[model samples]
Target: MSLADLEPNSLHVVLHVRSHPPKANDFHWGLYLHRDFEAGGTKYHLKGADKRWLADHGTTRGVFKSFLLIGLCQVARIPSGLMKDVDAMFRTYDHQLNEMPGLTCRTWVFRVLELLQKPHSGQVLLECNDLTSLEYELLSWGNANALAAADCQQPRPTHRSDLCGL
Candidate 1:
């Protein structure tokens, strides 16, 4: 279904998983998403929760794309709770990665988190095996374009200082 089919208040959850073992110096990570709530707050149900293992060098770029698509369908803010959820997910998967010890998995977690938090400004390049350059570019470009357009529509301050004839 197209993004238009989604509910106006619907949220998108993107989970990024790493596959390889961790190195002597690396951290494992993951990503998740949820709907933004009003001041009253909202609840998320994890029904039918399941886990899927990713092969070596899996890209979390898809999650970014999904968020963009959902955002495009309807304008919405990222909920505070959703950010907490993403952090918690990272912690959990980090622990899991520690047990198995995959270098690739350990490294990509922070990269994915960085992308989710700040797509365009993220220091981590999506060109690495962990993420697809195409998907990363698409999501980053989409977000940048949307933000630029929105900024253009906003009113700029025209009042100048020294109006009192100093």
Candidate 2:
């Protein structure tokens, strides 16, 4: 499925967790294309050791960190169709950030969404194979955002802090 199919200018936010011997063990998160497609940008595409990731970027290592997608949510589906190329846009966005090593995936999600134009539904939902910790931050992000939108006085708790133990 191509990201275009889900609807252009939309983001599919996913939460992942893997406590195995493959590599690092921790809760992870990433973004994915809504539709199965021929091609999309590096960030929008799910790049990793998988064949799907290799076919596109020619590297087993991809921009996305979360592998074993445990949960997902259409964080915001902008009705405004994206123009130019989604990948190209992401390149510009990433370059602007001057991404450094150890860049948090949550930060990536927060930043990429900034490029999209306004006027979108704030509602979000997550579906995971198992019921787990991903739900906590999912609600945390949503709750913190709602508080900010309303200009709440209390400082929201740092997300990554007790959530991931990172």
Best by lDDT: 2
Summarize candidate 2's per-residue lDDT along 1-166 as a digit string, tens digits: 2233344343455554443321323434555543223343233422333221211212122223233443335544333343234334445444433334434555455445454333223422222222235445575554334433233223222222232212
Top candidate on TM-score is 2
Query: What are the lDDT scores of the predictions, listed in order?
Result: 0.29, 0.38
In candidate 1, stretches whose alpha carbon ends up further than 4 angstroms from where it belongs are 1-77, 105-107, 110-130, 134-166
* TM per prediction: 0.22, 0.41
Local accuracy of candidate 1 as per-residue lDDT tens digits, 50-163: 232342222232223422121221112343435444434334443343334343432444344344443333322122232343234324433434432333322211111111
Candidate 2: lDDT over CA atoms? 0.38
> In angstroms, how far off is 98's CA in candidate 2?
5.9
How close to the true structure is residue 44 of candidate 1, measured as C-alpha lDDT?
Answer: 17
Where is the poorest 10-residue window by lDDT in model 1?
157-166
